[model samples]
Structure formats: structure tokens, C-alpha cells
Target: MSIDRVVEQIRTSVFSYKKLADRLAERPSERVRAMIYLKEIAAEYNLGTIEKFKNLLSFTLVKLYDDIDFSLPTGLDLERIVKENNVVFVPNHQSHADYLILSYVLFDRFKFIPLIAGGINLNIFPIGDLFRKSGCFFIRRSFNNNILYKLTLEAYISHLLSSGHAIEFFYEGGRSRSGRLLPPKYGMFQILIETHSQLDPAVRRPLLFIPISIVHEIVPEQGALTRELEGL
Candidate 1:
């Protein structure tokens, strides 16, 4: 059998098993069902369980993007970066393909990198749902005053980092409405610091911050971003 056939079979079997398990487990909500399915697959694969689902998702993403002509930078030591340290990948946001591109570069080359994404109304769709199941937690975009929500997010992020998962996120809050790199938002940084502070000194791990810059010579949304930035 071809590799493509094998991969498709795996995907089908996993999804089918997940559906059956969700039904048996009495998970009534779609969101919850999806979450359960992810956890089950993660466990079955022995890839670190649900707690490490983000890494598994990153692996899947890299495979998906490899079908394209995506390639990683040369002479960069990906293994040492991903395997040896708790990494926080901060990339400049540009295209909608940022997630797939980065995931492909990291996983296809280095192996595993877990990514986090903002959960907003706009992210609710088939692709969004796929990301969430693959291990992306949603963050509320406008929860400016929601202290409880902020704390919960912080805690979850801390938990993941402390457990040795490599994290990837866009530091520029949202995608650049302009072609230029927007000033970095300190929310994610602040949360990382706070989480670091709370870690028991004896059990703490070194966190490595990696900044990735992606430059597209010709942006597809240049016109749209220019218009949006002008209005701002």
C-alpha cells in the first residue's frame, strides 16, 4: 500500500474511533466531544497523552504542509532548540498560512512544537475546530476585564511550559493589518514571567525564547491590510 493510503487509513480509523468513544462517553457538546477524541488519539499514539496533544497536532500540521513546497531555514540547529529547552516561539504574523508554515518548518525539520492560538468568534469554523482538537486552546480576544479568564489561561500556559512542551505563538497580538511588524503585545510574555516566578526553584526549567521572522516578498493581503491600517 502507498504511504498516502496508509495515512488516510490512520486518519479515518482515528476519527471513527473518536466518534464512537465520544458517543459512549456521553459527551453531549460538540466541543467536548472533539476534546475527548483528541485525548483518545493522543493516548493511543503514546505521544504523551492529551496533555501533549499540542505537540501531536504540530506533527500533523507539519506533515500536511510538507505536501506544499515549504522548507526550513538551513544551518539552524532545530533539534537542540526543540528537544533541549522549554521554547517559546514568537513569530511575526503575516499570512493566514503562518500556522501551517511554522508548524511544518518546526515539526518536519525538528520534530515537535506545540502552538497556542487566540480563541475568538472569527476562529470558530471547520479549521478552527481542527486546530482546537489538535491541541490549540482558544483565548478570548476582548476579555480585557475578565480577571478569572486571564488567570485560567495563565495557569494552563504555565502548566504546559513547565511540562517541557515547546510552545509557538505570534507575539504581535493579531495578524498585522499592515505589512510591517506590529509592536509586540506583552500579555503572553507577562504570563510566562508570572508562571516562571511561581515555579518552585528546585523544579524549574530554563525557558528559551525564540523569535522567528517570516518575510513574504509579495503579500496577498497587502491591499486589504493597507486599507484597514489607513482606517485605524
Candidate 2:
């Protein structure tokens, strides 16, 4: 289904609930509170016009910091991988800048702009709207036992994959506060596996799980993370 149709279906079928067991998995009061967030996230999937914004972002980044230098694993052929299949890009979590850096790499190298999995927390404020327009779709950090919420997420992801859109999500789950590699969290991967199982075995094998590595010479979030750890 198209994004508009999918978003509407989710809004009406999921958030229109009146109780915990109902559509949105919340009481009326809770649903009322989440209305804004829910809508913001739904609108987050709107990703038609992005090149203009992406180019602008690249320009701003160049002025603020040094150019980003990253690399794909040796012997891993991105062109060959995507020739006959969709890609589920799993990159390491390091800094907030990873989004733009990877986006630039994907566009410049492969001429692809993927649907990224972003945190719902970042789905706030003026910047959030910009990021959404730049092709981000929000994902809450934890599902918190809400099956309908999980279903909403799965449905969104499934829609993108089935539609042949390349996807990018941090296999490390969140930014590494310690500047160390966090063990990969496979929850999202598991969901994709389940989605893959529903596909024909031949097609399933062709879907590439591309593992990308990002190394930053300098990280903007470094100072803030240190301060946060110091509890000051």
C-alpha cells in the first residue's frame, strides 16, 4: 500500500481505540495524550522530497565539522548485493551524526536514499520535522508490552520492505555512550526474519543484510556524553 493509505489505515485501525485492548492499546485519556506524537510519527513516513534538504544538510555539516570519511567492508560489493534484492542496512551506533554521514555515503556511492529507523524521542521539535522530511520513520525505544503498538511498527516496516524500499537501522539499537561497540540487539532483526519467512525462499535468500561500519574521526556528541556520565 502507498504511504498515505498505510498511515490512514494505521491511524483509524490502531489509534482509534478506546481501551487498552482496543485499537491503539491505550485508554481514551492515554490516546488523547499520545495523539500529537502518534500523528507526528505517522507523518514522519512522508519521504518524497529529500534531495534538496540532504544537499543543504551536507553543506551545513561541511562548515560545522570536517568531512565524514567512512568505508564499506572490504570484499563486500554493494552494487552486486542490491542488483537483484532489497537491502536491510545495519550500521553501528556511534553518534547522532551517523544519520547524515551514512545518508551522504549512500547517496553519493549508491545513489540510494533509504528509509531510516529513528528514535521516537528524536521525533520532537522543529528538527524532528526536518528529519522526517529527510526520510526518517520513528521507532520507539521499547514497546512496553503494547502489542498494538508493536503491530503498528511491524506493519510500517513490512510495508516499506514489501514495497522494495531499502532500510537502515542501527543494529546496536542506540548510540554507544561508552565509545565502545555494544552487542547487537536483534529484536528488529528478528522481526525482519519473520517478515522474510513469509516470502518465497528464493527471494528471501536474495535479500541482503548489509552490515556497514562507520568510523568517525571526531564525534560531536562526545562532550555531552561525558558530561552525562559525570551526572553534572
Candidate 3:
């Protein structure tokens, strides 16, 4: 049997097991709860086990090209970073593939590194659900001016960082419309530092800032940026 077929069989078996477990018990155990969560996420995202298998397969394809020379380092020291301190993996955003690239590198090569991603906008189709289930939380991009909401968001981020979660975010708030490095936005970083300061010294883990430099021979979005720049 092919690898894809094997993955499909595993997913189907798991789903069947979850259904049986749910029917047999009044209240599910933690393991069952976790399975239910995954099932819900997959269903909401319109992702069957087959779709997720495809995403992983896509990740594999990207990995094949991960080592292509770009005059900069591609491999991240995620294990070392996670072992020693709390980290925010800040990388320059260039392609839509950035998240998958980083995720594959960290998870496949270095083991499980949990990352918190900025949630996709609600208007986006099925993919948004996929991203959310894939470990992203929503943030209101336009609510930067709302003080209460901003503080709440910061607090949540602080809580995540303080708990030693390996977080990843683009320093450039959004994808650069222009294919150039934009200035770093410190909103997330500031929250992390402020939260760190409030924690007792003995309990606080030092926050490590690891800058990921992604160099591509060609910017995938160069055409869009060029058109905008030329006022075309």
C-alpha cells in the first residue's frame, strides 16, 4: 500500500475509535477529549484525514527545497532555542509558504515546537479554519487603537510566552506589499518583555530573540509589489 493510503487508513481508524469511545462513555477521558478536539478542528476546516495528509505531504515537498542555497542559513536551532529559554521566532515574511517552511523545519527536524500564529481573517475561505486548527489564534488587525482589546491581547500573548511556548511571528506585522524588509513591530515583543518583568525572577525564563533570515532567489510576490510601486 502507498504511504497516502496508509495515512488515510490511520485517520479513518482513529475517527472510528473516537466515535465508539464517545458513545460508550458518559464523559470522555482526556485522550478522548483530545481526539474529539482534533476531529472537530478537522471537520470545521473541511479537512478530512486525507486533506491533512496532503498538507503534510506539501510540507515534505517544501522540505526538499529547504536547503537550496540562498546565501543565508535556512535550518533553525529550534531544539536548542526551546531547551534554553522562551523564544519568539521572528522571521522576515516573504512568501505564503513561510509558515509551512518554518513549521516543517521546527517540527520534523527538531521535534515538536509549538508556535502561536496570528489568526487569518474571517472572510477567507476554508483555509482559515485549517490555519486556526494548525495552532493559530485570531487577532483583530484593525483593533490596534482599542486600548482594552489591545491590553487583553497582550496579556494573552504574555501568558503564552511565560509558559515557555515556542512562539513564531513575523516581525513585519503583515506580508510586505513591497518585496522589501519592513521595520520590526514590537507589539508582541513588548508584551513578552513586560510579562517577563512582572514574573518572579526564579520563575521567569529569559526570552530569547532568534532572528530567522529567509533568503529567496526571487520574491514570490515581487510582481504585486512592483505594480504597486509603479502605480500601475
The 10-residue segment with the lowest total lDDT in model 3: 38-47
Clashes of each: 1, 0, 0
Reference-based lDDT, residue 119, model 2: 89
Best by TM-score: 2
Q: Which lDDT tens digits does candidate 2 get at residues 104-169?
A: 777767877778888889977887877776778887888859665665565555555555678888
TM-score of structure candidate 1: 0.64
Q: Candidate 2 vs candidate 3: which has greater TM-score? A: 2
Q: Go through the candidates in order and give each one's C-alpha lDDT.
A: 0.58, 0.68, 0.57
Between prediction 1 and prediction 2, the one with superior lDDT is 2
How does residue 152 of candidate 1 score in lDDT?
43
What ranges in model 1 sit over 4 Å off? 1-76, 226-232
Give the per-residue lDDT of model 3 (tens digit) for 122-164: 3156766556555555565555665434444444455465556
lDDT of 1 by residue, 1-232 (tens): 3223433444433333332334534644443443332332221112333335445656765554444454447876767766677778888887666665666455555666465554454345665545554445566666568543454455455556556677777898877745689888888888787776766566467888888777766555777877877895
State the RMSD for candidate 2: 5.3
In terms of lDDT, the best-performing candidate is: 2
Task: Give the Å error, residue 63, model 3.
Answer: 11
